[model samples]
Target: MTDAIKIDVWSDIACPWCYIGKKNLEKGLAEVASDEDAPLVEVTYHSYELSPDTPVDFEGDEGDYLVQHKGISREQALEMADRVTDVAREAGLDYHFDILKHTNTVKAHELVHFAKEMGMQDAMKERLLSAHFVEGRHVGRVDDLVELAVEVGLDADATRDALVSEKYVEAVRADEDQARAYGINGVPFFVIDGKYGISGAQPPAAFSQIARQVWAEHKEEAAAV
Candidate 1:
């Protein structure tokens, strides 16, 4: 069996459930680590914008946008946010839906690509989600994103140059293309070892179970070979 398992995650920073899913995945990783025979796992976060065309200075409320896009009532959208907020809170995250300023997250994903080049993708992803959902920061701005990258141990000037020059734009686009090819229609989708697909912000126990099952199957396949 391979000693390491690779987890590819497709998500966007503007996605509230993505943050919750990330937390749940972390819980699952911690649980798996407690198992003596658990294989090592490396995670890579990929770009998947929920609103690729959203303007930088979006004027309408997020509830209005959701209502318009999904044809759901404003009340229903609010209820959905409340449900997601409860899930996030259970995962030890604070989500301020009322204060959330929704905007295009393409630039944020670009920053994630830049961080990946610096081997700080995980830190950058966590910080970007926290900044957007909890801190209500403007993640679309290049300067603000650079500041966040620096806070996560990335080189500030390099990140600034990358953002200014639109470096890694192709990488972000590549991730989007891959997501489309995989028929992913939602954020927080996971591909485990390029073999199994898991969707949504599943429970921690569910993630743990999948990890264990995948690891076991990989081991058995390797033994047979």
Candidate 2:
């Protein structure tokens, strides 16, 4: 049997580019799914908070947060959001930045770790991103996080308990530590087989080409062994 390709992703739920990159990467992986020779690909998501200092209940909208965070004018922040919204639309994502709740994502990250234990990590990640970007829901609170977890087929009470007790705080911190060790300063970063690192939201073709190349190299190395 051919070995699977490991794709480790570091991203935050509040990141717009991370969602775009995820969709594009999925599209890229789909491009080679029908090829019998293609090796399996396994994706593991890690925690990376773009704005760890952001408050759980920010007093303003995304533009307001951006203005303070990026030190840009309100006009410039809105323009940036508009540009990202357009790009997100092209990726089949409907991003409603106007209604987005710009909140700290540490709790959301912990929820993802809980889902990982339940074998629903990817679903939780998707839900959190959509909740934050598309649905404009609050993800920084335990109540909201628990609801999102339940939506992904996780136990509600258990989810609540986990969040309240901070069951996955260490796990989240560990992922962050690993991210720092890797010198990763950005989200939507892809580490392929723990060797090749692809930064930012790349084109779908880029993901397809790299996956195929990695699988081919893995096959060659196996044969040589």
Candidate 3:
């Protein structure tokens, strides 16, 4: 039996490149899945907020906030987003940049933690990212996020109650703490097999190459035993 390769991904829902990174990683996995010697990959998404103090209903444009926080010119921010959008399109993802609603994602992360208990973490992660990036859904609200959880096969009522009660806040916080301990300063950071760390939104080919290398190393180690 092949051992499973664990992948820990740190990202935020509001992050545009994180969505692209997810698509890139999926493509990489699809490529590896067809190979006979590929090790099984088990992915777990962690929470990392780009703007934890962002209001639930932030007023004005997201670009304005970027300008205020990062002190980058509006043109620079737009250009950066445009570049990421191009990358996303190449990865076969449709990004609705105009409709994206920026807000605090702490509750959304909590919902993902709750979904982990139900064995729907991947589905929940995709849904949350899509809801924030493409669907213009407000992920900061407990009721809205509960509906998203229902779509991902979680119990909606229980999720709603948990969100309102802030049940998994600590779990989300723990992930943040872990990210800090690992010196992760950006989103879309990938930790392969808990040993190798790959940062940024790397291409699918890059991920596939790493997976193949890791699988080979595992095989050699096992054969020597």
lDDT of 2 by residue, 48-109 (tens): 99999998999998789999999999999999999999999999999999999988898999
Model 1 residue runs over 4 Å out of place are 222-225
Query: Per-prediction count of colliding residue pairs?
Result: 0, 0, 0
Residues 46-161, candidate 3: write the lDDT tens digits.
99998998999888575776787789999987787788778888978777767777788999998888889889899999999888877778888877888899888899789988
Kindly report which residue pairs in candidate 3 clash with one another.
Answer: none
Per-model TM against the reference: 0.94, 0.98, 0.95
Who is ahead in lDDT, 1 or 2? 2
Residue 151, model 3, lDDT: 88
The local distance difference test score of model 2 is: 0.93
Which residue runs of candidate 3 sit more than 4 Å off their true CA positions?
none
Cα misplacement distance, residue 26 of candidate 2 (Å): 0.6
Tell how far residue 144 is off in model 1, in angstroms: 1.1
> Where is model 2 more than 4 Å wrong at Cα?
none
Q: What local distance difference test score does each model get? A: 0.89, 0.93, 0.87
Q: Is candidate 1 or candidate 2 better by TM-score?
A: 2
Q: What's the candidate order when arranged by decreasing TM-score?
A: 2, 3, 1
Q: After superposition, how far is residue 199 of candidate 3 from its true place, in Å?
A: 0.5
